[model samples]
Target chain A: MQLAIVVNEGPYTHQASDTAYHFTKAALEKGHGITRVFFYHDGVNNGTRLTVPPQDDRNLQKLWSELGEKHGLDMVVCIAAAQRRGILDADEARRHGKDASNIAAGFRISGLGQLIEAGIEADRLVVFGD
Target chain B: MAQKKKFLYLNRKAPHGTIYALESLEVVLIGAAFEQDVSLAFLDDGVFQLMAGQDTTAAGMKNFSRTFKALGDYDVRKFYVERESLAERGLTVEDLMPITYEDENEDYAEKPSIHLVGRAELAAIIADQDVVLSF
Candidate 1:
């Protein structure tokens, strides 16, 4: 089955990102095709490369980016939500007159249309949030 | 073309306070353009989203309650408001906004869009969905 994941909360502050990450890994291990992972609301914070966790705690942003790199996943951060939360890509940062981009590797900023498209195309769309 | 999927957007929070309600509405608006079978369920504090006379002026937020009125224009008609949630919160159906849509097939007659249901019925609706999005 083709699965699409939607994360609505940011990392660390909530267990939503961790649950989503584990669910994604489990689904991939079961051989399910993950078509897209959309980051909305505070969930866009998961795409920021500036996060630095303690030596003991896991870095969720890094985990998601690494998962995407390994599985060739489409990690999309909603542009509207990202902008509201200050999560930006290189081009978006440049266009918006920001100093720098913080979008972690393997994540792309796009519109809400991508989320709707994922629901239409993927076999399942699972949302994780508070 | 892909098969039309049954999409159920689950709302379990109130409007304002958090950004979920507004952002979820954004998705619902965009999702309507896909022409898929879509339905919305309001549970827990989610029922507060449908109450009438919502004034965000004091809250200093954009009054997004009006957006629910425009949902009917997008061919998104099914809105399941959980009865238990409302009753628990000491609210009744009359307290909610009178949201309606024109039934194009029935000579464009205006019809009520909100469907008040019990927990069991809402559960069945969720079970029938191909995808369930909660925020």
Candidate 2:
């Protein structure tokens, strides 16, 4: 089955993003096609490259980026939510006259339409959040 | 043309003190453009979202409760408010805003949009949907 995932909470502060990651990984291992992974609300924070965890703790941002890269998954952070929370891509940073961009690899900034499209296209849309 | 999918926007939070309610409305507005069969479910504290006369002056937040009135214009006519949720919060349908839509199929008759339903009925409605988005 083709599945779409929506993550609505940030890492560390909530277990939502982590659970979503494991679910996506397991689904992929079972050979199911992941249509898209949409980040909204505080979940957009998962796309930022600026997070630094303790040496012994797991790094969710890196885990997501690597998973996205390996699976060629369409990992999208909602642009409206991202902007509100200060997660910016290089283009967005330049457009807004900001000095730096923090969006990590394998994740792109996009509109909410992508999420609706995913809902329409995928057989199931799974959401992980508070 | 693509077949229309049943999209349910599940609301489980209060109107203020958090961004979930507002942001979920944003998605509903955007998703309306796709022409899906959309429905909004207000349960738990989400029932407060439709409460009449919401004054955010002291809170300094945008009074987005008015936005629900505009949803009828976007062809979003189904709003399922759980009966149990309202009773738990000591609210009745009369406490909610009177949201209505013009029915084109019935000589443009103005009709109420809110549907007060029981938990069992809501579960059945949820089972009938192709996509269920929670906030």
Candidate 3:
């Protein structure tokens, strides 16, 4: 089945992003197609490349980026939410007159329409959040 | 046009002190453009979202409760408020704002959009949906 995943909380502070990652990995292993992985609310924090966890701890941002790269998944961070939380792509940073962009690889910023489209296109929409 | 999917926006948080309720409403407005069969479910603290006379002046946040009124204009009408959730919060349907929509199929009659339903009934409604987006 084609499934869309929504992660609504940030990493470390919440288990939502971690669980979503494992779920997506398992679903992909089973050969089910991923329609999209939408990050909203604090979940947009997962797309920032600035996070640097201790070498011993698991790096969730890297994990997600790698997963998206391996699966060619449509990983999208909601632009509105991202901007509100200061997670910016290079273009967004330039537009906002910020000095730097922090959006990690394999994740793109987009509108909420992508999420609605995912709901319409995917057979199931799974949400992970508080 | 493709088949219209049933979309449910599930609300489980309070109106203030968090961004979920406001953001969820934003999605509902945006999603309305897709012409899907959309429904909003208010349970737990989410019932506070529809409470009448919400004054955000002291809180200093945007009084977004008024936005719910505009949803009717977007062709997004159904709002399912769980009966048990209200009772637990010591609120009745009368405590909520009077949100209504004009029914084009019925000579443009003004009709209430909120539907007070029991937990079981809400569950059945949820089962009938193609997509359920929770906040």
Better of 1 and 2 by DockQ: 2
lDDT of each: 0.93, 0.98, 0.97
Best by DockQ: 2
Tell me the spans in candidate 1 whose CA falls farther than 4 Å from its real position: none
List iRMS (one decimal) for every candidate: 1.1, 0.5, 0.6
DockQ of each: 0.86, 0.92, 0.90
TM-score of each: 0.97, 0.99, 0.99
The TM-scores of chain A alone, one per candidate, are: 0.98, 0.99, 0.99
lDDT of 1 by residue, A1-130 (tens): 9999999899989999999999999999999999899999899999999999998999999999999999999999999999999998889989989999999999999999899888888888888988
DockQ-derived CAPRI band for the predicted complex in model 2: high
lDDT for A18 in candidate 3 is 100
Interface RMSD of 3: 0.6
Docking class of 1: high
Where does candidate 3 clash, by residue pair? Answer: none
Q: List the residue pairs that clash in candidate 1.
A: none
lDDT of 1 by residue, B1-135 (tens): 458888899998999999889989999998888888999999999999999999999889988999999999998899999999999999999999999999989999999999999999999999999889897
